[model samples]
Target: MRTQTLLTAMLIGMATPAALAGPAADFRAADANGNRQLEFDEFRVFVDLRANGGNAQAKKVRLFKAYRLALGKVDYDGDGIVTGDELIRFDRANGKS
Candidate 1:
């Protein structure tokens, strides 16, 4: 628990934005391989299994579009993928303290 707290603190400190995005747990889960990054594949699963609830096949046809939107929204580097730092910054900018 202590480690987790530290990690969360680190994440928040690293974040650059000022609004809440999603919970840290959400980002951690979405970041497969624990690489602190979310490739389209990881983002896809995260989107489908988000707290809102949805199935993988439900948005198969629109995942690509969603990816593009995600890029525009949080992929600050425009590197075709979402990083933990970028997401944290976005989250903070949105509302997360």
Candidate 2:
């Protein structure tokens, strides 16, 4: 019984992040002008995700830089723009689905 309970708890813990990740990504994508791709200005979403009840303002600049790199990498085409199709392709290629 204890082993079963432990296994269930482990499974739930592992699943939680994956479940939460989608919603967060959706939220960020929406705020990114409905493009489903993130831009530098959209860094706010990621910043909000990483910020806690502490030092949010302090972390702003660093988060912006990190978000820039992250967004750049995901843009993939280097066209200075990202489309919904591109995002979907990226997600699939990265095994998001």
Candidate 3:
């Protein structure tokens, strides 16, 4: 049973990075200006576009807070920008990889 549990944990850890690859690709594509970083407006648009058709206006305040929190996590350097490398580091820190 212990061996099986260890194997399962290993598998999950390995798959985490692969699962995040799609989001990384989406981030790259969402970088319209190709500045290699996501600014507030760009990140906002990306979040809205990926919002699954939800009525953003209905939850404007809540959504804004959530967006800010997400961006804060990725903007590790606190420079008001999110780069791909920062995103990867964020994911790792958040246990997504």
Candidate 4:
């Protein structure tokens, strides 16, 4: 999957999503390998796209910080990978499921 699309997928319940698709859509697009795990580098791109500011560089910085902050919460295994089951659990916990 493209980096941006994957990044966007990892963000399951953001109030202001940069991508038009919802969490399920993003997840599906990212999990192309059928392993049901979304490896995020593109997820970073998705977060970067959500960063607001006039400077592109500033947005990138924000994206990295934000992504790091969020990674742990979603990556339950600490493996730096988010599986479909993980997303579902997260969404349910957040009442977004």
Off by over 4 Å in 4: 1-12, 15-21, 32-34, 45-65
TM-score, every prediction? 0.51, 0.41, 0.58, 0.50
Global CA lDDT computed for model 2: 0.43
Candidate 3: stretches off by over 4 Å = 1-21, 53-65
Q: Candidate 1 residues 1-97, lDDT tens each? A: 6543333333332232223244345556767788877788876555544423432322432443444454455677788788757766665665654
- Structural RMSD, model 2: 11.6
Cα distance off (Å), candidate 3, residue 71: 1.3
**Per-residue lDDT of 25-87 in model 4, one digit per residue for the tens?**
554554556565667764554334444323243254455565664555667788987665665
* Candidate 1, lDDT over the whole model: 0.53
TM-score of 1: 0.51
Give the per-residue Cα lDDT of candidate 2 at 34.
64
User: For residues 1-97, could you state the per-residue lDDT of candidate 3 as single tens digits?
Assistant: 6543333233222211124554445556668898878897766655554443343421342344455655664577999887767656654764655
Model 4 has an lDDT value of 0.52
Q: Pick the candidate with the highest TM-score.
A: 3
Per-residue CA lDDT of candidate 2, range 6-64, in tens?
Answer: 32222221111123564355445535566555465654454444344232431443444
Worst lDDT run of 10 residues, candidate 2, spans 9-18
Tell me how far the alpha carbon of residue 30 in candidate 2 is from the true structure, in angstroms, after superposition: 5.3
Better of 2 and 3 by TM-score: 3
| Candidate 2 backbone collisions, by pair | none
Model 3 clash pairs are none
